[model samples]
Target: MPVHRRPPLPGVQRLARALALTAAATGVIHLGVAPAAATPADPPDRADVKAQVDQLYDEAEQASEKYNAAQEQQKRLQREAGILLTQVAAGQDDLNRLRADLGAVVAAQYRAQGLDPTLRLMLDNDPASYLAGARSLGQATARQNETLRDLRERQRRLDQRRQETAAKLDELEQARHRLAAAKDEVRTRLARARQLLGDLTAAERDRLAYDDDARAARGADRFDLGNEPPASDRAAAALNAAVSKIGSSYVYGSTGPSTFDCSGLMYWAWRQAGVTLPRTSQGQASAGRRVSLAEARPGDLVIFFKDRHHVGMYAGGGVVVHAPHPGARVRYESVSAMPVNSVVRV
Candidate 1:
């Protein structure tokens, strides 16, 4: 049979030849890797992973701070609750005593046998004397009524205090429960690594555990923000900025005009005072000067641990300003929440 000619588009035939020639030089497999149709470069992917990892670290940092803040808030509420409850109890006691006294006075004078009217009237023979005796009786009645009114007022105050105490107690209990639940989640994750080792044989398990311990020991040398704050070109200003931020509400993941996440606030605060800081807590920790809290001053950075995380700025008066984390706003807290790990001078 004679060959039949087939029509080719203008550039099709040339393109086919070019691809074949290119494929022959490189491998046929690599022909699929056009300049446009290529996998992302390691740098870009790495940047993404790093970004994600940074975010995770930031999240963990925030969670830890939140746990600590909720802890502090709960304690404060509880303490106040206790004090209010005590006040309520005291008020009630006072009210009871007053009521008892009033009852005794009334019993003695207002009973059927009280106020010997016949004798009293007999003693008042003249009109002037009777009028004076009548005035005295009216005054006595008025005093008793006033005493009753005062006792009722105390009782009302006592009731109000009790209600306030109860409400605050409820809030404290709820916050405590929330913090406990968060801690439990952290505990569960920590245990997950150990559980993974269970699949190993006895000797293997022992070996893995040993390796794990060694790794942990090495990890201990890792940077802890617990040390002194990083020495800054403008240390005084950084400290002042942080101190000034106290009483602010804690905001998780915020760097703040209005709110701040734990690390975010640290980052932003320092920036405001003409200093630059790392975007993540770990990075910030690595950059500061480590000092003992006893030597701490108003501008020092205070760091804590529940795993070598959570940092704050000392605001003097035993209080610190920190972003606290999720479910909180940038605010002040007592340094007692976590024995400060280290104070940084930055």
Candidate 2:
């Protein structure tokens, strides 16, 4: 009786993979390396340190976002690799089957008293010199053909395996690096925050705590998006796609194949092209290259109102696509109509 063996559970494997990937990215993103270009031991002021820490936190968030993106890319690639491996296996099976059939044909041809083509030529030649040369050549050709076939098959498999291995290793290593970097970013920010706490006088600390409590009452992350989106190839692609959707109809909160509201249009376009964007219009407005109306590209999001009260996809030809109001379909209207604010290029 044969013992049954079960393959690993895909769900379990996927979960494990997710954890491993997260761990690796954390490790790579958070190196315990020395600080960037040491300065004099003036030991920065508490407020200054606090500001620096805040900046570092911003950096950390950026790094975390990047790690998340890389993680997704790595996962996608792994699935692709598996598919490629399956194709490689099928190729090998087909090759072996074909070789077996060819062997049978060759054997049957020789067994029926019909000469092996290779041997026939040898027998037809002069007994000494000609026959000897014919025999040597025939045997050499036969051996060479077999060797060539074997080598070709092996090479093909080897090439495919090498490509797959290289891709996996590269993605795995990248994920590991990102993990480390992200962790380090968080750790550094926490350290700086702690240092700021230490520098505070008792009364100042109390005041700070009071301010924190006051801010807490407001109930918001208060996260400032102080910088532009990192320069990336995806930014351009995303921007370009959004630009093309100018004047498309909108349905409030609807992602689209054709129509979209302000945020819905962005979400749908980015998600469709495999680039993730935030779900809400306000979130989408802050997610990319922040710019002024003068700098806005066709694909960039043109935000409106002082507090960013509205948004629209900047479709060129002096038009933008957006849901006009609460109970309306998204449609394209003049950029001039709305109070144009900041622009965000993905």
Candidate 3:
């Protein structure tokens, strides 16, 4: 059966439709905003990442040089301490011998106590014989006094050597502490750099490598290393040795035929040339006669930064070959690539 009902108003129907549409739109907006809110922030660009990584590597290199300096100092102190120990032992033996000799002289005098020199002189039948015996007694007294003086001098010298050894040991301990701290700093910085690099996408890392290669290429193309002779035969040899290590990986504090740090590379190269440079960049800065950048020749050490924590061997014509930093290989770059601190002719 059909029942009669009042008809709904057009405005009421339209209002109901509008409310339904509004609810659907709200749901759609919420669904769209949820994913947008969950998305992560964009990663840093290659240039920014490279700059940060470079800075970290630079800091790590500085710490590595400090570590090297401390290690060298520790080795020197150990050697010096060893020598001092030997000297002290020898001096002690000499003192003991001298004391034994003095004890023997005292014992002989005690055994002969009953024979006083004055009494013997009075009792002797020949006055000349008594006078000769008195002269012999005087000579014995002089020898005992000389032995005492020698013993005292040796004891003083032994004390001095002991003090020197103690000082050296103290210095060595301090150097060890410094070495540990520097090593930790280098590791921390390097770890941070690695983490940053790891955060980068594979494509981003590849791009960075490409950029580095391109930059190196550009630097090489611009720098003209003419056939300028090295300052000396040794210099030429050192330069050749450094150049031969191109593509070898850089490792913090390494001074080797395979891996090297900035100063380590210089040290190793100079060693190959029959010269020994200092183990740290700061030390190497003063290792030889200082020269102007314009006077720089092949095998000359080019120091970088005011702190002088970085070093490279000059390859002439405003180019240098260096171990750069960790995660990098030995390569040639323009001398002006970093701030030039000084030039040293070794």
In terms of TM-score, which candidate is strongest? Answer: 3
* Cα error of candidate 3 at position 265, Å: 1.2
* Candidate 1 segments exceeding 4 Å error: 1-59, 111-131, 193-346
Q: What are the RMSDs of all candidates, in order?
A: 18.3, 19.7, 16.3
Worst 10 residues of 3 by lDDT: 1-10
| Candidate 2 residue lDDT tens string, 117-196 | 55765676555765665567677568757865875877688677768767776877777677566556645655665666
lDDT of 1 by residue, 257-298 (tens): 666656667777788778777655555666667777677766
User: What TM-score do all the candidates reach, one by one?
Assistant: 0.44, 0.41, 0.82
Best by lDDT: 3
Q: How much does candidate 1 score in TM-score?
A: 0.44
Runs with alpha carbons beyond 4 Å of true place in candidate 3 = 1-41, 115-131, 210-223
Compared with the true structure, all predictions reach lDDT values of: 0.59, 0.56, 0.82
List candidate 2 segments past 4 Å from native.
1-46, 113-161, 198-342
RMSD of 3: 16.3
- Candidate order, lDDT descending: 3, 1, 2
* lDDT at 88, model 1: 84
Per-residue alpha-carbon lDDT of model 3 for 31-117, expressed as tens digits?
A: 885322333444655555666678778789889888998999999989999999999999998888889989999998778657876
